[model samples]
Target: MKHPYSPGRVLCALHFTLTVFLLVRGRPKFLWFRPLSPEKLMDAIAQLGVCFLKLAQVLATRADFFPLEYLDKLKTIHDQVSPMNAEEYEKVFARAFPDPSCFSFFDSAPLASASIGQVHEARLQSGERVAVKLRRQGVDRLVEKDIRLLRGILWLAQPLFSRLTRNSLEAVISEFSDMIRRETDMLSECENLEQFRKRFVKSDVTLPEAYRELTSSDALVMSFIDGVRIDDKEAIGAMGIDGEKLISKLVVFYMEQMLIAGFFHADPHPGNLLVQKGGRLALLDFGMVKRLSNATRIAMIEVVKAANERDFELYILACKRLGVVAADAPDDKMTEFAERIFDIFGDARLSASSMRDIAFTTLASMRDLPFKIPQEVVYVMRVSSLIEGLGTTFVDNFNGVKDVLPVLKSNLTRALGAEAGLFPTIGQELAGLPLTMRRAKTVFNDLAEQNLHVKLSRETLDLLEGRIRNMMRPICQGGLFILAAFLVVGMELPWKNEIAVLLFAVGALRIVIGLK
Candidate 1:
């Protein structure tokens, strides 16, 4: 069946693609092309509306994917998105609460607005204060259309990317599509809130109570959360909360989410996190959440253990198991990558900015190698990066690697499903000893037979060859001029001078044309 394409979607997709294309062409290597300014790119994304704004929020967390200037602009996108107008707000409220008597009083103004919904402070008939989350009118349909448009664009460009790159791109789009679609459903968010409440019931971390009786598909009513925004350092200090303790507690809570529970709140921006009196943390907005499979979680544990132990081979193996590094990635190159990674984490004294610089540099180099970050790790990285950003706001010289590695190392036993008993852990390791030995033996045998294969896919080889050719062209041109000069000076033939001039002319022409 043929589907009708709207003009608006067509224009949006074209603008999105052109902006990205310009950004790529504006890289340092493309000297002839005019550079795309970060401000222009951010403006373009903002014009694309809420769906793209959400994407920009995720992209902002990726220091490796963009320059620092671009990251700075992207970080501001989510907070700056415009809220719904009065007419739209009234329409949604009416549809969500047809009875009109559910709330005794609802403020006309929203307390906060986001890409998917807006939150308003209201009071129930019993005089209890609540925050009502109202979904934007037709937002679900808008999300669906936007995702379809994005998916179509990606499908058209699939043949241009390598298999590994294609897989990673597809995984990202798929993850975002599923996440945003689910986010439009207020019921699912309510359930997520309830699940978190149950999980963290014993912890000092606070969660607002969900009013399931009052929630509907378009609106969710919950107990209002009151506190200072986590980033408001002055307010926190005035409230007599220890900044250091709050930072430590935040790290510990995230450690429980990522390393132990395997399920976590994906969005940890400052606005979503609050610090109540006595250093109690209140987490808000559960619309965006992520879960790690058992395999992925265990592989992450292995990655942490390998990094802490400085085991290069183990690190690469863990990366492979986590679906980040290709299984057939060359061993020597993987070792180099592992070394670069270890250097980033080795120094506890490195500040967040310095560590970020090292990490970004390493990742920029990795782009040329056979590496792909999986969908599962995308949000994990985002959460870590966002939390790291938060930590930097209050704590001096905060580094995520320094903070997380210790917590991960200490919780390895519990994360591995072993109780706080040495015997069970020993038994578990002994049970896997034979398999581990067999794998080691196989690797050694391959090395002995000189069968350590290096498989660079055709696309990667082509790209590398292209870069090499470009590099050698300039040298080859200079060599030609030298040869021509040598012939003119040394040879006595009548045509020698003519030949040298022709050679020089040809080389000069080639150089001139190459500049374009």
Candidate 2:
């Protein structure tokens, strides 16, 4: 189907093409085309509309794609933007509130504006103050078109990038597409907020109570938060809040979200977090939430435990299990990589630039390896980087390694799903000892009976299958050509020559595409 707005498609296509061109030119080999300045690049992205702006924010978390200078500039791209125009406000407001008597006092002006939607301050008829988040009218369609446009651009540009870069780009765009689409659905955001509210009841962190009765697909109503942005140092200090203590709380909360509960608010930027009276934290904007499966969460815990213990081999193994490192990745190189990472985390006084340099150096050393960031871990990396950035704002020597590891270590048992005492856990394991021994005996008996055989891992089998299929394609095309030649030379039918020619052309085209 055609885009709902045709002119928007044209504008997005032009700006996206320019943005890609500028980035390509930024490479050292592109001497003919001068790279645009970082400001110019940012302007191009901003002009691409709200979708690309959100994309730029995601890119800010990726240090491998851009240098520190570009990262510095991209970090300034905030979710806050110009509020909706009168036409957009009227359309969304009318759709959100068919009955005008829902709110006794509803402000037409938005309290805050973002890429997906804007929040308005309102008072319910029962005299309760609330904040209503309204999805921008027609934003879902716009986002759909923008995602399609980006995919088209990526398809056109894929040949220009190396395999690793191509895969990374695809993964980033795919993850961002899923996340942005989720953000456009206000009902889903309400559900996410309610889940978080239930989870945070006993914690120091606060979540706005979602009013399900007053919510719909177009809008959500929740209690208004009157708190200071976590990064506003001056205001926080004026309120007699300890900056270090506040950061500690934020880090601990994140640790609980990621490691203990396995459900986290992916966007931890300062603007999405607020500090209420008495140094309490209030998390906002639950549109971009993430959940970790049991296997992933367990592997992540192993990664942290291995890192804290300084076991390079264990760390690399955990990384492989976590799906970040290829299963067949060379142990020596991976060990070296783990060593460098541990060294960076070991130094409390390491500056962000120094850490970046070390990481880049390691990546350069292992450039040939098939390292990848899976979709499941994309937001994990993003949240870590953003939280580290926030911590560095208040403390000079702050890092996630230095701050979060201790918290995770302290909560290890709870994170492992063992809330009860340790002796009961030991007793439970002992109770299963006979069953474990029986399974071991079965494996031994199979070996003794000569029934044991080597089995390839699922990943290895898939890789082999793909390689075999690729190798056979051209062979099959050549066979088709041979059959066509035979038909032309031996067949006596009236249409034999015509069929032979058509078959020959089809075979040649297939072979040519495979070679390309």
Candidate 3:
């Protein structure tokens, strides 16, 4: 089926390629993926370059599902992707920088390389030490193919899989795809870096100052940050630096990132974090940041309270309010899951027992639950692991989980007024009751006086435009199915008319609901 503009075709080709490669794959990587663990596969995919590598990195951020082996292995697939050669660097510099002829002192060699792009150690003609990041030439198209293939694979697997909802998986992938795509636009990333830096102005965490004059859509140049990578444990030890304090700073750093500033470095792995000799963790790569809205921030505030008070139910409720939980989950199922989580949460606070004991007990208790966790839990669980992983490694006998609760508790108490309740909000709304009644009476009076009235404003115009746009999306999609059908039954082409009609129906229903 040679459908014009079908991204699915690229996906089909990739599927075929992977299938053929795996057919000839080493006997080690077979039946239930034993040939290569999920982690090793990620490394191989990273080696393959393009989107697959990026995917492995994102999945590595998600430690909730994969075992510790995969997490440890995939974490090593660092930003060390192959760099573009000198010739390509020159061409890109010429394209991105104006007055390229005047350029006297830019390094042709990359300073660093990740799966998607490489950073070159460069000096401007102005004698500034800058880091130049260049997007790999063919990455965008590869990402497009990779994203399409993932969607196709998920769509095809919907009926066969029971562990996850297709919508849920697709939503997470779409978000990650959006983030990875943002990395392609170096200009946007530069702006993001500046924004994050600005947000963290007073904070100990900092980002490299992006050199706007040397920056462009394809290339980003920032003042070179000089520090040892956080993972350089040997160097850390040699300097006699406090690793536990650094991690403590990170915990507080990330807490402030989301809580106070409402801007967070979504990827805060050991690679992206650098520890200065004085102990400040220099945050790198602001390209994949997440900004929380006021509402989201409030939800997170509640999450802090819940995590501190050992309130799993409130945490679950907060998750639901934040739209982090799927709506289709059964109430009882979620409650039971919450109960099990509470057991873990309570156990996590136990000081008498070791982490391994708590973990073992938690694992044993999980056998009593029927509900599975959503993938987003990985991001949260990763935080827990970071606290524990870095904590145990540096601060012997230090329970990161136990330590975090006190900080969160003390902070929440100081920030949110120890006794603020729903009553205050209700009272505020009640204070506006007179105005609401006046408006209601006015509406009724207008109806009686003029038979009908609809006050119109620019706000109404904006609302109407939003409604129209939503309706148009589904209609435009339906048109494709209609066109496909016309070619099938009308033009006598061998086609899946049934599927086309179904798609049309789905689109029509969506449009109808949009209008409603």
> Which rank order by lDDT, best down to worst?
2, 1, 3
Worst 10 residues of 2 by lDDT: 24-33
Clashing residue pairs, candidate 1? none
Clashes, model 1: 0
User: Local error of candidate 1 at 312, Å?
Assistant: 2.2
Overall lDDT per candidate, in order of appearance: 0.77, 0.79, 0.62
Q: What lDDT does candidate 2 reach at residue 38? A: 74
Model 2, range 243-362, lDDT digits (tens) per residue?
888988887788778888889999989888999999999999889999988778888889988877878899888887777766667889889876776678668777766866777776
- What clash count goes with each model? 0, 0, 9
What's the lDDT of the predicted structure labeled candidate 3? 0.62
Best by lDDT: 2
Worst 10 residues of 1 by lDDT: 24-33
lDDT of 1 by residue, 1-516 (tens): 012246764665555554443442234523243434678767666666667777767756655556667777777765544578889998999988998797899997888887789999999999999999999888898888878888887787666566666676677778888888889999999999999988878778989999998888899999998999999999999998888778778877887787778889999989999999888999999999998887788788888888878888888878877877766677788988878766776677776678768877787777657776678887887788788778778765566566656666776676766744988778988999999999889889999999976677433564575566676787688668857767786778788877787777777777666655
* The candidate that achieves the highest TM-score relative to the unseen native structure: 2
> Which segments of model 3 are wrong by more than 4 Å?
1-36, 61-64, 67-72, 101-104, 238-240, 323-392, 396-400, 413-516
lDDT of 1 at 149: 81
lDDT of 3 by residue, 1-516 (tens): 233126655444344334322322223332343335454465456445555555555555443334445556766665565567677656766777767543456666666677667876766677777777777766666677667776666565555333333334555667667777887788889889988777778887657998886677887888888888787888888878888667777777767766666676777667677877777778788677666676666776787787666566776666655545543344566666655545544454454345445554554444322222333333443445545555655655555345665666656642453335678757877899999999999889888889676665322443465467667877777676666655556654455677667666776776677567
Question: Which is the better candidate, 2 or 3, if ranked by lDDT?
Answer: 2
